[model samples]
Target: MLKIQDLNAFYGKSHVLRGVNMTVERGEVVSLLGRNGVGRSTLCKAVMGLVAPVGHVEFDGKTISGMAPHDIAHAGIGYVPEDRAIFPGLSVLQNLELGMKKKGQTGEKWTLEKVYEWFPRLKEREHTPAEVLSGGEQQMLSMFRALMGDPQCILVDEPTEGLAPKVVADVAAILQQMAKDGLAVLLVEQKLSIALDIADRIYIMGEGEIVFEGTPEDLRNNPEIRKEWLEV
Candidate 1:
């Protein structure tokens, strides 16, 4: 589980992520939705300690706000950035190997074989260089690589950005399966329909703060909140 309270971040004099508060319980999928420039990615970076944070970020009941990124990761949090961030020259299998918490240590919950079973495309391309894979394949690789670390929770940012509809559906299904398997998932997404379909709860952000917190049904019923904070 993850909890963030009064979380704030800054880029020099410009403040982002103003006093944000949220939680992700185990077996839950919580989506953070907002338009561009609203600090959704900044919140992920702050929680991962890539950005300096001014408030509490607790995971499994201990403070992780100031910890180094690697340390935070070792404490059981995974991050999949908007940019996919795979190693271009490395083989697909090699990139996944690098995700292990310790070199050669495949943790209990996730293994290379299990990942292959989950996504056969990855198995087919196991020996191929990562740079040659399609965008959707690359995205799947990114998520599975994080799973190689055996994290208790994952912070996923924009997982379906440029994929085709089918690929987006695949990604959404994988995220839901992750929640069923008991990993707390914090998804920062641009696709409203995907978020609404898979998330147990939703938090809408505007101007760097959470403006709405409710279930997907509540969000569906609130047209005003959608118009003000979410719609383009």
Candidate 2:
């Protein structure tokens, strides 16, 4: 339940996102795929209120464009950035504990226990300092930390940037499970196969605009679109 219409973003004097329009429905995994410098990650930051944005960002029918990052988060949107922002000194458990919106908040679907269940490796390192974890582990920590907020929608930017194949599979499975659990997942990924495999709908972005919107099969079948906008 997220909608973005005519959205624009800028860095200094250079414009990044231009009239970008997209939507994500409940229980849906929508992938924004493009090569580098197309503004995919900026779109995620714009939606999360991490960057200055113009136009409308509506979540569940309410506008969130001008809201602060925490305000947008408390409104039921979570963000997992490409760089895993983990507190180096904090223990895994402490990091997760801080992830909660408020102490002992109930009625939320995700919990520390549930997150641990999803990634048992995180449970194993429960008391370890976050800085010691591997890249994959750090990524898991970042995602689980966001889930600790029990968001209705999660904007995940480059979830599988640099990881082993098995770890990438794990991350893909987790995103798939998130959709099955009725969370709207907006994934900005460069990996074509992974995105096509998990996304219910695919939006191909180019130069701050959506060039193609279709299903996985449609993307696979369209060589022209792939060659021009996607292939290196």
Candidate 3:
């Protein structure tokens, strides 16, 4: 579980996340939705300690605001950036191996075989170099690599951007499955439909602050909120 209170983040003199308050409970999928330049990604970075933040950021009941990124990860949080960071030269298997926390860590839920089972495409391309995979494959690989760490919660930023409709549906299914399996997912996404379909709770951000917090059905029925903040 993750809880953030009065969180603020800055880029030099410019403040990006302005007093953002949100939480992701265990086994829940919480979607953060907003238009561009609204600091959705910055909130993710601040929670991951990738940027300097001022205020409280607690994960599993401990303060993690000033911890190093690696330390934060070691504490059971995984991050999948919008760019889908993967090693171009590394084979799919090798890329997954890099996600391991250590050589002998045990009791983990994710394994190479399980990853192969979950993603047959990854299994087929197990030995192929990452550079040769299609965009959708690369996105799957990114999420798979993060799962390799056996994280309790994952912060995913823009997982469906630039993908075909089928691939987007695949990605959404995987995210939903993750929550069903008891892992918290803080999904930062731009696509309203996808977020509405999969998220249990939704938070809409605008001008770096949360403007709406409600269930997915509540969001869907409220045309004014959709028009004022979400609709393009």
Candidate 4:
């Protein structure tokens, strides 16, 4: 549902992404894996128009490069940053209600009720401030805030970062459900197992370029790629 080609990005003249290219098919869970210093996050930021890039970013079928971040969000793309951007003082319900996107199809997948179904804890804590949530609840809150947009595609950067194993499993399960609901997911994660669990295809990125692309099994078998991009 999204395609990025020959994209290059920079932060204050320090180029991060170097002619990167990748595609996500409808309903696909595509994972982009890389070491800490690689440009996985940069690529996601560039696609969402949070960072400047020179090249093509197409969503569904139109070019979105150079668009403002708000316009990109309105174009049916949801982004969950590595750092969970929850409003510390806002109630859980209020936070979720903020993600009504302008371009997504009106579907049954991500209504407030539906999000609560996926995360019953959210229902239980409807009035709680975001700062009071545990790490796992905060992660869920961050995701629900974006999902409430009913996005056609989601860019999840490090959904499992800084969470416990059981919490990671919970997050992984939600991502699987999102894929099952036909929303394309482009994930950038450090945990190989978490990415492999839901990703239909994987890309190993380095120095702003995609160095490897394959199925989960293919990645597992390529010891060099695993050692280099993951297994840190």
On lDDT, the candidate that comes out on top is: 1
Candidate 1 C-alpha error for residue 99, in Å: 0.7
lDDT of 2: 0.91
Model 4, residue 75: C-alpha shift (Å): 1.0
Highest TM-score model number: 1
What tens-digit string does per-residue lDDT give for candidate 4 at 159-190? 89889998898898888888888898999998
Question: What would the per-residue lDDT of candidate 1 be over residues 1-232, giving only the tens digit for each residue?
Answer: 7999999999999989899999999999999999999999999999999999999999999999999999999999999999999999999999999999888888688899988998999999999999999999999999999999999999999999999999999999989988988999999999999989999999999999999999999999999999989887
The C-alpha TM-scores of every prediction are 0.98, 0.97, 0.97, 0.95
Model 3 alpha-carbon drift over 4 Å, by segment: 104-107
How many clashes does each candidate structure show, in the order listed?
A: 0, 0, 0, 1
Model 1 residue 165 CA deviation (Å) reads 1.1
Question: What TM-score quantifies how close candidate 1 is to the native fold?
Answer: 0.98
lDDT of 4 at 14: 92
Instruction: State, as a TM-score between 0 and 1, how close model 4 is to the true structure.
Output: 0.95
The better candidate by lDDT, 3 or 4, is 3
Worst 10 residues of 1 by lDDT: 101-110
Flag clash pairs in model 3. none
For each candidate, the alpha-carbon lDDT, in order, equals 0.95, 0.91, 0.93, 0.87
Error of 3 at 169 (Å): 1.4
Residue-wise C-alpha lDDT for candidate 3, range 1-232, written one tens digit per residue: 8999999999999989999999999999999999999999999999999998899999999999999999999999999999989999999988888888985442277888778887899999999999999999999999988888999999999999999999999999999988988899999999999999999999999999999999999998999999999888
